[model samples]
Every structure is written in C-alpha cells, then in structure tokens.
Target: MNRPTPAADRTDRSKRTTGPGPRGRTAGAAVLGRAAALGGLVTVLGLLPWLSGKDPALALLRARSAEQEPTPEALAAIRADLGLDAGPLGLLGDWAGGVLRGDLGTSWVSGAEVLPAVLSGLGASLTLMGAALAVALALAAVLAAPVCLRGRATAGTAAAVLASLPEFLLSLVLLIVAGVWLGLAPTSGWAGPAHLVLPALALGLPGGALLGRLVADALPAVLAERWAELWRGAGVGRARIVRAALRRALPSLLPQFGMVAVGLTGGAVAVETVFAVPGIGRTALGAAKAQDLPLLQGCVLALLALGLLAGGAAAAVRRGLLGPALREAALSLPAPLPHRGSPAVLLALAGLLAAVVTWGLLRDPYAVDLTARLAGPSAAHPLGADALGRDVLARLGHGAATTVGTAAAVTGLSWLTALALGFLPGTAAGLAEVANALPPVIVGMVVAAVTGPGTAAAALAVTLVSWPPLAAHAAALAQELRASRFLQAQRALGASPFWIATRHVLPAVAGPVARHAMLRLPGVALALASLGFLGLGAQPPSPEWGLLLDESADYVERAPVAALAPVVALGLLTVLAVRLSHTAVRLRPARPAPTSVHTEGKTPLATPAQ
Candidate 1:
C-alpha cells in the first residue's frame, strides 16, 4: 500500500483529537442537567419528612393502630412497629432495599400493598390521561389547521379566545352543554366513553390551547428555514410545506410537553373530583386527606417517576430532532415575535378576577341564620342556602375570594421569589427543572400536612407547586439575556451583578414571567379546589369554591342549582384565567434570532409572519 494521503491523515488526526467536541459537551451537559434536576426533586422529597415534621404522620399511625395507650413509651413502640424509629439514612436504605425487591410497603389505612393499589389507580389515571392527551392533540391540530391553510394572521382571533380559558372552567362548560343542555352525556359519574367525553374535553382544552400556541410559535421560524426555502424554491405545495413545518416545529416543543403535563395531571384532580372518576387522583385525594404518608408517598413517587420518564423522553426527542440550522439559531439572538393573541380576551379575564375578588370580599359566607336551611335561589337568597343555612351564593363568593386570592398570592410570591431564586447563576435551571418534575397535588399535600391544614397552608402549597416553572423560565431567559452585548458592556464597565440583573435580566424576564403567571392561575386555582375537596383547604365556616362543592355533594338533589352555583362561578373564573394567559402570551416581544449563526454569503429567508 502507498503512504497515506495528507488529507486522509489530517482527517484521522482531526477525528482523534476532536473527541467529545461541542456537540458531545452539549449532550453531556444535558444529561447532567437532567440528573441535577432529578437530584433537586429528590432533595425536595427527601426533606419532606423533616419539613413536614413526624408528628402528624405519627398521629395518623397511632389512630390506625388498635393500641389505645397515650404513653410516650407506647407511641415509641408504635413508631418502632411502623419502622419510623430509624434515622434518615437508615430509613432511606430500608426504602431503597425494599424498592429493589419490588416491595412498596403497605398502606396504613387500607393494609393493602402500596404498589398494587397505586398500580390499580395508575391504570385508570393513565387511561384518563391518555384520552385527555389525545383529545388535546386533536384539538390543537384543529385549531392550527386553519392558520397553516390561511395566512399566519389567523392565529390571534377565535383561537386566542379558546386558548385563554382554564381547563377546569372548560370542563364545567362541557359538563353543562353535554350533560345538561344537549343531554348527550352524563354530567357526573364515570359510566363509559359517554361519561368520559366531557371530562376529557375539559381536561384536554387547556393543553390543546398550549399545543396550538407552540405550533403557532414554531411554524414561522420553521417555514423560514433553509430546508423550507429549498422545498419552496422547488415548487413544493402548501400542504407539503405545512406538514414539513409541523414536523420541524414539534421537536422544539418537547421540553414544553413536560410543563403541559404538570397542568394536565394537576388539572385532573379537579376533573376527577367533578366527574367522580375513580382514578388515581381521587385515590390520592383520599390518601392525602387521611394523612397516610406511606400510601401517599408511594402514589406520589410512582406518579413522579412516570413524570420523570415522560420528561426524559421529550428531552431525548428534542435532542434527536434539533437540526443544525435550529441549533445554530439556538445561540442566535432571540427573534422578535409578532403579536398573535387577543388583548380583549385578556381584559375580560382581568375583569372577572376583579369581580371574584370583590364579590368574595362583600359576601359573609359564615353567617348562619339557621332558618333558610336547604333553601333554593330566591329574592331573599340569590344563590340559596346549604343544609346548615349558610348562604350558597355568599359561600360561593367567599370561596371565589379564597380561590382567586390564594392564586394571586401564589402568583405574586412565585414572581417575587423567582427574582431571588433565579439570581443563582447556572444552577437555577436545574432547581427549576426538578420543581417542574414534581406533581402539584403532591406538593400541596406535603405543605398542608406540615402546616396543619388551613387557608394559608393551602396557599403556600399552591405557591410551592406553581413557582418552579416561572423560576425555571426566568432563569433560562436571564441566562440567554446575560449573553447579550449590552450585558457584556455592563460587565466590562464593572457593574455589580445585581445592577445588571435588575436593569437588564429582570426586564427581559418580566414579560415571560407575566405570561407564565397567567397560565399558572387556572392550574393553581384547580389545585386549591382539589386541596379543598380533599379537606386540606379553607377551614370549616370559611368557604372556598371546592370546599363548597365538597360540602354540598350530599345535597345535590335538595338544591341542585345552588350546589352548582359555586361550580358555575369556578367555571367562569377558570375560563377567564385561561383567556388572560393566552392573551398575555400574545404580548410577548419576540426574541430576535442571532445573525452570527449563519455562515457568510447567505441571508436567512423571510418568514410569512414577517
């Protein structure tokens, strides 16, 4: 054989020397990011026992056990019997060892194996989730089809309105139309596919709106890509281009799918509560109420594990699907997005929130006259009274206040706290990612259990669950903005980190923070509702919407309309919240794509929206 050519030798040397270059580094960073996020989640969960304290769980254990002695020795014996005597390390070791052997322990309340019981509920939850996910995707397609078929201007009209409403309120609307007005399906109870339709529709709509938005956002850039230009220059048809655009846009949205899943799964608590579905949410609700840590932990762990898997799958898909052009655009200056959603819808939502807050403040929900028990709506009582003579309308109003106020508080706290938490460089994303992986209901339960069930506890729980996404989004955006020229100039000029963050990073993060806050409202509201239904929210005599619904479950026939009044109010708020979120999303200033990503001699193609 002849001596190796210079080019071939150079290529071999290059290959050998360039191992795990930029792309490899990126992949490794992604893996580490995932691990870090998962670690944060584990940290939050591992600290739950300490954070929540052992007393409540111990008391619950005591009540479950037949021994009636109140001595410290007896309690310690009970704790020992239940395996609570071990230190954290030992406990973790035992738990890990058991998990390795396929043993998830037994429920304190049910005395059944935790794994099998949770698995039984998992089947139902997954079925419902699957049905809901499918409907959401289909609805998204239906919403986006016209935008692709028509010009991109078609995005901000009816679709914006549809996308704005929260999932629970949508569920209520479907319930009324399908079950009451149209009489096509049962309003409550899980019978078969007919009963499933309304709840699935409710659970799916918000997600559909999210998916639609993602599609709309992704479409413009996708159509502007070099590949799309090549296809267009070759005289490709609109249908083929639309298909190709959708394919390209979808992968970018993979990370978002996990975020959407939080809303989807969390939203299910309300859906399950209202539709009376015997799914895992309902089961988890029962476990939470009873303060059965073993069962609750098992259920939450299984659900969280599933969520982690879903998140990982989406990340992998995103990694695999990101083409060189999109990757180049990744470092590109974020593009300035066109205003694409309805502002009027957002105004309507804001008005409704004001109404709820006002109505709740004016109403005296706890005033019990005892004369108008189980009364119907009339001039004397506009929304009627419950079995205990509390005004249903007043209770509904107060409940609305609690729901909306708590959500607002949660929203405010999330943003305020986000500024601080997001200030941590590099690690903020990991913390946010971990928080995103956790289920809202699980967080709510832990907070409530620790704080001992009250409106404040409920609010705090909701805040903890809802804040992570905002923090993550803000941190990610802050990081991106930090790489900007102005920030670099500020840094070079010797400006303080805080000054740069406040002046530049915070402002950049503000719009996204606002948009995310709105989207979180419906989910947060639903979370409050769920916690109330589970008896961990709004102490008795202090009405909340979910609490009102739960209290009147047995009185549905006595005052059907009154029982439904709170639900209708919740529905209204949920709808408004959804609308506001979508509308706020419209106002987001589009990030400009960095021009430096492209090589010399070729300009990027113009997009249709441009």
Candidate 2:
C-alpha cells in the first residue's frame, strides 16, 4: 500500500477546513467594511452641505426665494461661517478638520456650537423615543400576550384589525376624542402624565399591533415544535406550555420590535407637533424648513444613528434568543408587501388634503350668528354647527381634508427626503434608522416653536418626523438588492447603481414599499388631523378634522355623526390602505429557492490496495 504524501494530506486538510472559518472571515470583513463606510459617510454628511452651500433642492428653493437673497455682507459672513467660500472638497476638508478638533460649527440661527445644540436635540429625541418605545413595548405585551395566549381566530382577527390601523391616525383620533372632545387631557400643550397618554398611544398602538401579529405568528409555530409537544406530553400545565412557547418565540419575535419602533417613530413626530411637545423631531422640521443645512443634516444623521442602534439592539436580542433558522428568516424577510397600483392613490389622497385646505380658506367660520344657533342639531345643519355656526358637514369634510391632507403631504415629502438620504453613500441608512427611532410630535413641537407656524412650516415638521422609516427601508432594501445575483448581473452588464436601483430593485420592492407606505397613510393623516384639532395645523377655522371633532365635542349629544364623521373617514381610509397592502402580499405567488445539500463520498481509512 502507498502512503499518502504530506502535500496531499495538507491539501485535503485545507479543503476540509474551509467551512465556518471562511464564513467567519467574510462576516468580519463585512462588519469592518460597513464600519469604514459608515465613518466615511459621517465625515461626508457633516461636510458636504457646508462645501456646496446648498441642499439637495437648493436650486428649486433658490429660484423661489430670489427676492429673499442674503446681502453680500450677510452672504459673506454666512459663507465664512459655513466655510462655503472654500472650494467644495476644501470645505469638506475644513469641516472634517473642525470635526476632528471637536468643532461642529455653530447653528446659523442660534450661534451656539452645533454639537451641543445637536446633542440637546438628540437627548430630547432620545427621551421621547425611549418613552414612546417603552410605551409601545408595554402595550404590545399587554395586548399581544393575551391574544396570542387565547390562540383563537377572533383574538387573531382583533389583533389583525388593530395592526391594520396606522399609529398616527389612531393616536390622533384618540387625541381629539379623548383629549379634546372629552376634555380629559390637554389637547395641545405639554402638561403632565396626561399629555403623554395620547402621544404614547399614537406611538404604541401600531407598534403594539405589529408586535401582536409577530407574537401571534411566532407563538403558534413555537407551540407546534417538538419541545412544546414534549412538554405537553410530559403533562406540563397549559400556562407552562404558553410560557415555553413564548420563550421559544422570543428570539424569532423580538426583532420585529425594531421595525415597529421605526413605524411608531414615524407617527410620533406628528403627534408631538400636534400636541406641542418640544423634541428633536420638531427640531428636524425647523431645520428642514429653514433650509438650515447643518441643523437638517444633524437631524438626518441623528435619525440614521438611532435606527442603526435600534436595529442592532433588536438583532442582538433576536440572536440571543432565537435559533439560527429563525434569526435568518426574520432578518431576511422584507416588510409585508403592499398592493400593486399607480401613484394615483397617493395623488388622490393629496387632492383630498388640498381640497380641505381650500375649504378652510374659503369657509367663513366667523359668519355664523350665535343668536341663530339652536341648542340642538337642526335640519339646516343636520349636525349642529360649531359656535361659529359654519355647516358642520362642510367643516368636518374640510377638516378631514386638511388633517389627512397635511399628513399625506408630510408623508410624501418625508418619504422623498428619506429616499434621497437613502441613496447617499455612507451614513445615510444609519441616519434614516435614527430618524425612524424618533417621535414625530417632538420634532413638530420644536420646529413649530422655532420657525413659527404656517402651512410650509407645518408640512416641513410633518416630513421630518414621518420620513425615517421609508428611508431606512429603502436603504436596507437597496443594500439587500445590491447583494443579490440579479443586481450583480446588471452591474456586470454595465448598469449603474442608480439604474439598477431604479429599474430592477425598485420594481421588485415596490409592492412591499407601496404597501408599507399605504399602511402608513392613515397614521400620517390622523397625526395631521390631530395637529389641526389641536389648532397647530393650518390655524383656527381651517376646518381640520381634529379641530372639527374638538369643536363639536360639546354638541355630540345633539350631533354624534358630526363628531364621528372625521373619525369614520380616517378609520375607513386606514382600513382600505392596510387591506390593500395585505391583499397584495397574499395574492402574490411565492417563488421558492432551489435547495441543494452537498453529499460527501466517504473513503475508507486505508484503501484496500494500501
């Protein structure tokens, strides 16, 4: 028998050792690469605007604001202060230099160093986001645990229904009905614990609903597992079985909290704004409106950071709890798909919001004579008019329009901002994540307070709060697609990243993004309406939905319908969008990947010839 040569043995060992080590190295490289990319992006994000002295929409904005051009002296001061006089790359270098020296520049408006101002805003945003997330987690546990335990179709259905409604809309409606109409809580101002209720609810509802679904989905699977069956066969108590199942489901399920958190953050901005809560989301809004590039950039960067942290936390938790299969599956799954359709739905929604604005502008809410007002609802106005005696129907319709309109506009604008940010190299995704982790109401309050109030300001505030999730998702999806074979093929075919993202990946992910976006509409609408109701949106007599509800609260006994109309519309629109998203996913045919497991042929320790 011939003995094996050392070279052959070494080669064989090398082949055998390539399993986990190579994969581990690859993962390490990926992590390092990601870190480097993020670092580079952070540097660029901090510097680029200062270098260009322009925002992404600077041209369009400048064209509109030509009359408001800064004087040469002011411009020079601004340029010197912002480092815009330096060439673009040079400015980037200067900004980078300043950053290294711990100088983030001062706020153009405040004259305070940018880092401290940013830190303060960041702290407020964190506080609000943390509170909101805690509230959401608590609510999710309270609501989802019971429904999952029940394990019945009705419980599942109830959970689904709750999940279907957007957080912003639900919270806004409650804020109006519970806070304004009932006068149970302060509608606008940041009071005490009472004020937290509506905003928290706005944050918690959608998150809780999503958690419920995640738990529900995970629970049943866990319950059916061999371990669960073994425990059951061992005569474990039902409660014990539930506990075991939940324990098993924990890892698979918990990561969903991050996604839910992102969704809630999106809603919280508007809620905060409507309620006049001061926070980072509001600051971001102010920055966006003022085109305070540094402030806006800071806000975006902060948002992305928060998202990364949340996502990372969720991932860590998930990995700690769940099996590899569950972890991979949960992370790999794209957000639930949305219905296939044109931008028509979005456009229509925009129109509706616009119509409401027009109505509010046109309607003379002051003309109603108090002497003509009856204590009860009359035929002239089936639903009793407000103290102003404006037709309640018109008011309600217009209110719904304004509230929903503002939300729609904000959502659209926010999504666009998010998309743009997502496309940027480096820190964009992280910034998006941070934004997603924030609360909209807080953003709104700060922006409104600083910039003062107007449609432009309000819209900007809404967008700042609303855009993070969309950006995170877009960036995430793009990253994922970039890794896929199809994308690689396109790249090999000489397609640019932009072209690939726009042509192939966008179409593939559109259904899901659209669904998510649609699902978000009601919440946005509700938040917007809540703002109107609170008298922060479009101002008084704007006939905003939330405002109408607030105004009609006293007359609910006389005109329940008037008070309920806006609520009903909000609810219906939310339901329709959610359903369409669900249906889109359900209707799509599943395409399974081909599985192949390599079979190794075993050789005897020694060949018979040896």
Candidate 3:
C-alpha cells in the first residue's frame, strides 16, 4: 500500500471522530424539538383569548363605542359575528387551522386583516434591525481591531463604557444631539432612510461594544493556535492572519451574536417608541392596550419567528465556520480579560449617582410650582423643572428608589428561581432556550392583559422573563462540572450524588451565576423602564425613570436638560453595574483543575474495585 502523509492520516481521524451520521441525527432532532416548541407556543397564543378572562365581545363593544351598554342579546350577536361563541378548544382548533392556511384573523379594533398589518410592522422593524445590525458589526470590527492586533487595553475600556450605556438613554441622547442640535438626522418617524440613522446608531453602538469586547477577549486564543503560528512562520501577512483569527473566533461568538440580534428585536420597542417608528413592537403594545387579542397574537408570533430565525442563522454560521476536527472537539473559551484602569472612575460615577439620589430625597418630588415650569437648572432646581414645575432633582432621587429597588427585587427573585430549577440541567436549559425568545416587552403585554398595567405588573413581567439567563448559566456550569475528571474521581470514591453536587458543584456554580444575575440587574431596570415608557408600567406622576423619559420627550427641544438628567442617571447606573460585575468576576476564586482531588487534605476515600 502507498504510504499516506501525516495530513491524510489526521484528516481520516477527524472524519472518523466527526461521524456525519450522528451529526445529521442531532441536527434533525434539534429541528424537530424547535418545531414542537413553536407548536406549543402557537397553541398557547391561540388560546390566549380564553385564558385572559376578558370577553372579546365586551372588548370589541368598548372599542367600537364606549357609550354602548352591554346586553345579553347584543353580546351574543357580537360573539356570533366574531365567531367567538366557539368554546376555547374549538377556538384554538380553528385558529390553528387558520394559521396553517396563512390566515392570521382580523383585528377587532381596526377591522383589518391581522397578517398584513403584522407583516407591515414586521417589515419596518426588520429594516431598522438590519441597519442596526450593520452598524453593530461595523462598530465591533472597528473597536476590536485595535485589541486584536495590538492588545490595546484602552480599546477594551472604551468598549466597556460604550456597552454600559442603556439603549433608551442613548437613543434620546442621539435624538437630541444628532437630530436636534446638529441637525444631522431626523429626530423621529420612519419616512425615509435618513430617519434610520439616529435610531440605528443608538441601538447598534452599545451592542457593537458588547460584541467587540467578546471578540477582543476571545481572539488572543485563536491567534495563539499552532496553525496561526505556522502561518506566521510561513510569511503570512498580519492582516490575513488577523482575518483568519477572526473567523476562528466567530464560531464561539455566534451564540452571543444571536442574543444581540434577539435583543435588538426586543429593544426595538423602546427605540421605536422614542423615535415614533411604527414597528411590530409598537403595534403589539397598542394591541395590548386595546385588548385586541388577534392583532397582538399576530405581532407576538411574528417576533417569535424572527427570534427563531436569528438563532438558526447563528447556528448555521457556526457550523460553517468550524472544520470537522474543531466541530468534534470541545472548545473552551478563555476567561474574559481583566479590565484595566482605576476603580476611581467607577467610584466617581457611584458618588455622582448617590449624590443625585440623596439631593432628590431631601426635597419633595411631588411639590409643583407652575411658575418654575420648564425652568433651567439653578441652585434651587439643580436639574431644572419639568412641565408641571416639579423638581427634576427630587423626582430623579425618588425614581431611583422605585426603579432601582424594584429591579433589585426582581433580580433576587430571579436568582432564587434559577437556583431552584438549575438542578435539572436538561430541562432548565431547554426551557431557557425557548423562553429566551420572549422579550420582556412581550411578557409585559401578557402580564398587563392579566393584571392591568402598573408598577407591580411591570415587576411581575420582568421577573417572569429574567430568570432564564441565570438558569441557563447555572445549568451549563453544572453540566460542565459534572463532566469534569475530579467529579468522576469523586464518584469513583463512592460519594453520593447529593454529596458531590453540594460539595463540589454548588460552590463552583453559585458565584458565576450570582455575578451573571447581578450583571442583568441594569437590564431588568431598563425593561421596567421600557414598560413604563410604553404606559404599561408605573403610571403618570410616579417619576419612574422610564415614565420620566417619556414625559420629557415633548420638552426635549425646550428643556433638553430635563431629558438629560434621567439619561445621566441611567448611564451612571449602567457604568457602575458593569464595573462592579467585572470586578467581581476578576476577584472570584478559581476552581481547581480537573485532575486535582485534594479535598481539605483529608484521607482520600478508597476507590471501588473495578
């Protein structure tokens, strides 16, 4: 037989290890699972009218004419006309059948076909999202280039700061500075391409920063690989090597990219509301407020489809990027690089936030002075006055208590729930994968429908959706630890499952999960704010940050400071959270290596005989 080269031998080995048969089976099973999940979601949405406990006939009557009084005959006639007299099961079956036939039903409020309206809104949102994704990718490449090439620490810091800014606040700032002050772009509405510039930048900049940081953190390992070294030794150009490294790094980053895409879809709600863009998110909010279940259901289903498509696209790209050898091997990404720079900046931001909250608390936020309405900042009104002449400083202070306190509560509750469910990694991870597609805004709509819109409703909505990430993290870490060699050795020593989990697993999982949850606190606050901005959370006069932002929009030109005040507070809070989370991660105790088995230096338990 002819002697085979080493490369051929390696290729053959890789082919054997990859086993295309198993890969195809896994892919098919995944598709089936996703389809089943989608079907279940569709079923739940189809039955929503019944589950909401609100009479569609009564809601329709109110929508048509609030003056109309309900009578049994009129209700029956309305139900007959709308085909709602069908029992819940019948309605579900009919809806399911209609969906299969490409009919999304008609809107109760507008008397329009739900599918067309939903598609129009989805088209708008997709246009905006596409532009935003471009901006994000461009920004990530620019920011990460320096770090990847030169390992510049400053680039990472810049990315962190940029990433820390909340989407709503950034959008408003962009609207004011870029749209109002410089006249560089349209402030609101979606009449033309120019209208997209500000909102797209607003949405994409932070996401790009986040993505760039991930790329920067992961590229070092890729560049250090033996193939990269060999290429460099063979006189490969730096740019070409960097490009290859990026492609290598991309497979690991694809999942995060999917998350960022879904986040863009979810975040369109707040951005759309601010910019007056008629996207599906805004449409869904309107339908929710109107109790138009058909329209809302159509909007929700479209969003879900978009989310699933994003995830599938990411997976496809990842598979394309990885070679068979890499695909079959477990890729352990390096820990995130430690943030460089002084804690003083973080402390200074914390101090500023604290001062604002303290100064506001010292004054009465509810007190109104019509004479001071729209007044500029002064000694008495440090942050100026709102339209109602209430002290902006006082409101900001009090709002912190409401907004931040509720977010903290939601985070704590979510952490507990994640911990409780994390023992079942398979179930928790699967549920999280499905739930990840349901954004907080959508969840808020459902909760508002059931509980009515208020601060409590907003809190409940946020709590419902916030646990998935934490649970997913805990589950992933648990799975990783269970497969570790030390854990196998422990099992060989006759340790009970509970003992192994409690002694080895919980300690390894808790810190990271808690940090992850802490990192999400700002996002929870932002979600609550988004709900309030959409009028689904804290009503008028509550001074919730989101409500404050909403109230300040009209006066953005007259008193930009009023808007700037809340934006600054939110920005500071975000920066502080990011800094603290990073610090915590850096300070966390490292876990023992897989082969290490020193357990408090006690006499080792004897291994069971084979």
Per TM-score, the best of the predicted structures is: 3
lDDT of 2 by residue, 281-321 (tens): 66666665555656665665666666667668877887777
Count steric clashes of candidate 3.
Answer: 0
TM per candidate: 0.78, 0.60, 0.84
Lowest-sum lDDT 10-residue window in model 1: 601-610
Residue lDDT tens for model 1, 1-610: 7988999999989989886864455445545755877765555554445455654434645556657656777667766755566767656666667667888766766656888888887887888888888987897787677668773635544454445444444565566557766788888776688778888887776667666765765676667778878998999998999887766666656666655665566667667767778777767767777766666667677777776677777767776677655644453212425554466766776687566556656767778878889888777677788988877767776677667778778778878866665555234444545556555566666666556677888788766545554554565566678888988999999999989877878887887777767665665676677567667778776687767767776676678777777666665655554454444344333442221111000000000000
lDDT, candidate 3, 180-214, per-residue tens: 88999998898999999988998788778778877
Report every candidate's CA lDDT.
Answer: 0.64, 0.55, 0.75
Candidate 2 lDDT at 397 equals 57
RMSD of 2: 12.3
**CA-only RMSD, every prediction:** 7.3, 12.3, 8.6
Those runs of model 2 whose alpha carbons end farther than 4 Å from true positions after fitting are 1-74, 96-102, 147-150, 322-567, 588-610
Sort by TM-score, top down from the best: 3, 1, 2
lDDT at residue 299 of model 1 (Cα atoms): 67
